[model samples]
Each structure stands twice: as C-alpha cells, then as structure tokens.
Target: MGPPALYALLMLAVPLATIFAYTFWTQDGLTIDRTLTFSNYREAFNDPLYRQLMLRSVWIAGAVTLATVMTAFPIAYFVSFHVPQRRKALWIFLITIPFWTSYLIRVFLWKVILGYNGVLNTTLLGLGIIDEPLSFILYNANAVVITLAHAFAPFAILPIFVALEKIDRSLLEASRDLGETHLTTFLRVTLPLAMPGIVAAALIVFIPTIGDYVTPRLVGGPDGLMIANMIQTQYLRLNDAPMGATLAVLAMAIVAVISALVFLASRLTARIWA
Candidate 1:
C-alpha cells in the first residue's frame, strides 16, 4: 500500500488493537491479565449507571451542537455576505482568537463569571434581580452547554462561512432576476448550498463535545457527569485499566455511529436538493 494508506492503517491499528486487547483482557481488583473474556463489555452495557451516563452525554453534546449552529448561522452569514472582503478574514480571526488561550483557563473563567461571588451573580444581586446566588448556574447541564457553545462557536462559524462564501453569486442573482424574494432565494439557494458546511460544523463540534471531560468536570456537578467522567473514574480513580479501555472504546463507537448518521442525513438532503 501507499505511504498514506500505511500511515492511516497504523494509526487505526493502534487504537483498535488496544481496545480489542483490553476488552477481552481481565483484571482482579488491581491486577490486570491477558486472559480473554467479555465481562468488561458486558458490565459496561448491563450497568444502569453507565447506560444513563452515555445517554446523557449524547444528549448534552447534541444540545451543544444545536445551540452552536443556531448562533453561528447569523454570524457566518454576516461575515460571508455582508462584510467587506478585505475585513472578513480579520473578523473571522477575531472570532477564533479565544482559542489561543488555555481551554482550561476559559472554563475556569466561566466559573468565576457564574460562581456565587462571580461577576454575574454579583451584578444581578446588586440590581436586586435575585436575593441569593443561583447554585444551578455554575455546575449543571446548562453550564456545560453554555461553556461548550462558547468554546466551539468558532468551529461552527468558519466552516459555514467558507461554504456560504463559495456559493455562486450568479445563482443568487438568477433567483432574484426570476422574481424570487430575498427570503425565498435564501431558503432555496443559499441554505441548500450551505448545508455541507453546516454538516461539517456539526461533526466538528458534536464529536468532541461527547467525549469532553474537562468542561463537565470543572463546571458540571454530579448531575452533569458524562461517559468520559466514568472513563476517567475507571482509569484514574478505580485503577481498572481494562474497564477504562472498555469505556473509551464504547465512547468512540458512539461518536462514530452518530457521525455516520449525520453524514448520511447530509447526503440525503443534498440528493433531495439536487
């Protein structure tokens, strides 16, 4: 095979081999063995807590994806269609500038902003909006969704903007010339053309958000714990390497299946437009 193909296979092999090895391997308390067994996978699927955690992880990630896309579409449209070409690159850069900072720092910044003595609560209390600090603001599902949305917003914006920029101006002109209203033109012409970018942004945000441990751990309380949190518990807290590997593999499979479904849906939508 070619060099690229060989590199790809090697990369794929490392993770697949590791997971396969771990799934069949066994452990006695702290000691792990190479003996083959299905108990790890069985436990992961059969345990009620694991199942709930996985479902919640998927749901939170989906919410983040939807929120990012909804917020990004307008900013992307403004940059691609309304901004002067010379300034568009600068504007896009500004959108992504937050990433230069440590991601952990950013999440902690939100904690400072939302905590009891944080800016938000202080300002609200000063204004007499509420008598006390809201406990739910700092460590919950809402915090996870908000912080992830802020972190991943630029990822959603740039792709959709690039896709919108690539759309042929002549096609849009033709629609207008044929007496189509601006809204109609956008619905029929602009939106369909931008679907690819929307799909790309969703995959970019959704996949990573599902496995994100840091945001949930830092900001998410007990209720916001995800599959990644469990994997971390298995590996670090419990010292169960086999179970940790099993959870990692399960999370990977869930991400892959969701990505495949999004890609397939995008293809179907493209076909219908065609």
Candidate 2:
C-alpha cells in the first residue's frame, strides 16, 4: 500500500494539484504571475463562449453514452446468452478487433466514409439514392456522435457482457416456469442485474468522450467543437494556461456531479427492480 499510494499521489495528485493551483494564478505573455486570484474562475463562469462550450460538451458526451450503451446491450446479451460457451472467447476477440488499429486511423477512415465524395456517398450515388451527397454527416455533431459511438462500442459491450454472464440462468428458468413472457423476464430479472455494468459502461464512455480533443478536431468542424478544443486553444494557441486550468477544473467538477447523480439514479432503479 505504501508504494502504490505514493505512486498514485505523485502521478495523479501532483498533476491535479498543479492544475488547480494554476487556475488561481494569472498569466500575462510569457510570465505566469504567482499572485492567487479567482479571476480565471470568474471569467470562466461569466463568459458566454465558455458556457456554450461546457453545455455542448455535456450534451455530446451524454448523447454518445446513450447511443453506445443502447447499442452495446443487445450485442452483449447475444454474446453472453446465445453464443456457445466455447465460442464466447472468440466472439469477444472479434469485438475487440477495432482496438487493434490506431485510433487516429479509425477517425481518418470515418472521415473518408462520411465525406461528401467518400465511400458512403459514392455508394449512395451509384445506387441513385439521392442526386447529391449529403453534407450533414461530416464535420458536425452528428459525425462526432457516430464516430464516438462506434469507437466506444466495445467498452460498453464487455462490461455488460460480464454482468450478464454473472446472472443465474436458473433464475431465468424459474421466471419462465412462473409463466412470465420472455420480455417480462428480461425486464424484471435481466435488466436490473445488468444495470451495474450499464452504469459502468456509461461512465467509461461519458468521462473520456467529454475530454476527447482528437475526434472533434478531425470530424467535428466549427459547430462540433467541445470544451476540450477550447481548453487546447487557451493553453497552446493563446498561451493562457490559467484559463485552461480553470476550464479543466470546471469540466471535472461538472463530470463529478453528473456521474454521482447517474450512479445514484442507477442504484435507486436497481433497488426498485430488486
């Protein structure tokens, strides 16, 4: 415990403390003033652009979490219940194949797929689906959602699969013997049991997605940018480290509150179902 705790404090705590400390200071040109002040936080809360970016980040992250979890649940159920025991490992291996490739490459491939003259549009045009390629799919919030949902699908699936596997098949058999329909059994038994994994998967997707700068940079154009993009701008482009730190702290606080609410809500729901 001593070594691990010391390591955690050094790696995680020190960096976080430094960021938080930076938020209280001021930066002018090349000089970072050590005088403690709340000006950065004041500006962050009062600025309209910051407000917009924060809301947008939360909305996009929530959307991605919903889409990923909803899609992953069915696949996890299939793999856990329908697949043979011996082939379960194979199915999981296949599901993780996406992780084998570079994340940047995957983002680029999505660009090619969603671009006006890219593969999707080319195929649609050849099929005469429409006269022109659609412009709404690329470089927008829609593209961000689609790309992220695909990228984080495996993260959502594996946890839910693990949860589902832990469920007792005998309980399901008993439910069926009591004359409940499959849907009812699933709703009353399977779903509640799987809620833990669903919550975990949602958190895993939501937290990182909110902080992701790369996907938005590539696929998310002007309208699709998130708070992370703004943070990057403040830190690197404008050389405003204090403001960047302030934004980072605010984002973390927001995530913490939202995650707590989500976890509590899930627990309540699970208890009711139980």
Top candidate on lDDT is: 2
Count of clashes in candidate 2: 0
Global Cα lDDT for candidate 1: 0.93
What is the C-alpha local distance difference test score of each model?
Answer: 0.93, 0.97
Per TM-score, the best of the predicted structures is 2
- Candidate 2, position 23, lDDT: 97
What tens digits encode model 2's per-residue C-alpha lDDT throughout 1-274?
9999999999999999999999999997899999999999999999999999999999999999999999999999999999999999999999999999999999999999999999999999999997999999999999999999999999999999999999999999999999999999999999998899999999999999999999999999998999999999999999999999999999999999999999999988978887
Error of 1 at 158 (Å): 1.1
Specify the poorest-scoring 10-residue window by lDDT in model 2.
265-274
TM-scores of the candidates are 0.94, 0.99
